[model samples]
Target: MFGFGIVGLLRTIFRSRSLLWSLAVYELRGRYAATLAGSVWAIVNPLVLIGVFWFVTAYGLKVTFEDGPPYFLMVFCGIVPWIAFSEALSGGTNSVLGAAYLVKKIAFPMEVLPLVPIVSTVIVHAVLIVFLLFIMAVNGLPPQLHYIQILYFSGAMLTFAAALSFVLAPVNVFQRDTAHVIGAILTIWFWVTPVIWPVDNLPDWAYAIIRMNPLFYIVQGYRGVLLYDQPFWFQWPLDLWFWACTLFVLLLGSLLFGRLKPHFADVL
Candidate 1:
């Protein structure tokens, strides 16, 4: 399945290189169309949320950590990955259903649809990371060599999004309820994650749970690089485990999607 997915991805790209870019570009334009700020809203939207959360949590609620950094900045750091994961899941899951016309009528590569949302999301994720860099620098904290873990971590996340997309795409085709269920799951998963709190604040068992959270590794990678200025190290066995698991899950997702795809047309 791994080899098939790779070959499938390559073939899809070769067949619809233009379609891939066209859909991505069109999706971007359609999303921000007729808006006053146009493309600028992409960055502004998340920034606005950051400000709101920062204000409410940092000032309005008076939430603070024992040794934690500023409230907003910490939450913002966590939200970056969360938004990408959330948006990617929502978008990727619905990609096929949303593109019903292309899926039912068109004969081009269908995998690209699931990827469109992920691609769009990853672009914004990149921008968020850049903004985070300046935030760290202004605090007189340049990232350390260990910060490079962000890439490997992000790679794992993209793999997760892709794998989940594979699963949800077919699920969305069969049971529309999957979308609602996924939505609720992400909402709960947000709080379940440490976006609002620190892992250290939790008890040992809870901290262990947090450590096992796949998203936790991604969040830690971000903090390790942007906040701690660290890079990938042999001391970090988490990367090895994350990559191994990510690939396995993606392959499994691909197989499931392939096995289920035949019924998608009939069911949808």
Candidate 2:
């Protein structure tokens, strides 16, 4: 099952490379085509949320820590990847049903549909990273060599999100409630993942459990690279674990997506 799904996944992605880019680009431009704000809305949405988080935590709650980075900077770094993760999973899960027109077309690569949201979210993430860099500099934490490691974490996050969406999109089409369930799960998933709070503040046992969340790996990776100046290789254990889990999800999701795809046209 794993080998078959992985092979199909690689083949679909590679064979449909051009179509994937076209769909992703179209989704980006078409999302805000009629709106006045256009693509800027992507930047604005995350910025506003980040500002609210920063204000509520840094000022209202007076959240502080013994750290090289400021409270606001730390929050922003964590939130940026989260925004990508959330948007990708949320939007990608619905990509297939939303693109039902394409699903009916025999030639369309339905497997690539889940990827559309991942690509769109990455666009926003790139813009958010620029803003994060500026905020970091303003907060006295200049860009470090480790910042390059964001590419590694970001890729991991995109792949993880895409894998989940492949499974979710198919199931979501079968039972519309799957989307709603995912929405609720994300709400709970966010708090437990240690986005706003520091993992180091927790006791050893609690920290170990919380860090088990796959997102904890990506979130901490951002903070590690941007603020802590830690090398990606320094967290080899977690890296090993994250990749192992990612491979499992990718294989399982691919198998599920492939199995359910033939029925999608009828259901949709």
- Tell me the tens digit of each residue's lDDT in model 2 across 1-268: 6798889888988998888888988998888899998877878888999999988988898977674677777788888999999999999989999999999998778889999999888888998998999888887877776688899999999999998898899989988998899999999999998788877779999988987899999998888888888887667788888888888888888889989989999998
TM-score of each: 0.87, 0.96
On a 0 to 100 scale, what is the lDDT of residue 107 in model 1?
A: 62
Best model per lDDT: 2
List, residue by residue over 74-97, the lDDT tens digit for candidate 1: 777788888888888898889888
TM-score of candidate 1 against the unseen true structure: 0.87
Pairs clashing in candidate 1? Answer: 143-229, 144-229, 145-230, 145-231, 146-230, 146-231, 147-225, 147-230, 147-231
Among the numbered candidates, top TM-score falls to 2
Task: Give the backbone clash total of model 1.
Answer: 9
**What is the C-alpha local distance difference test score of each model?**
0.76, 0.88
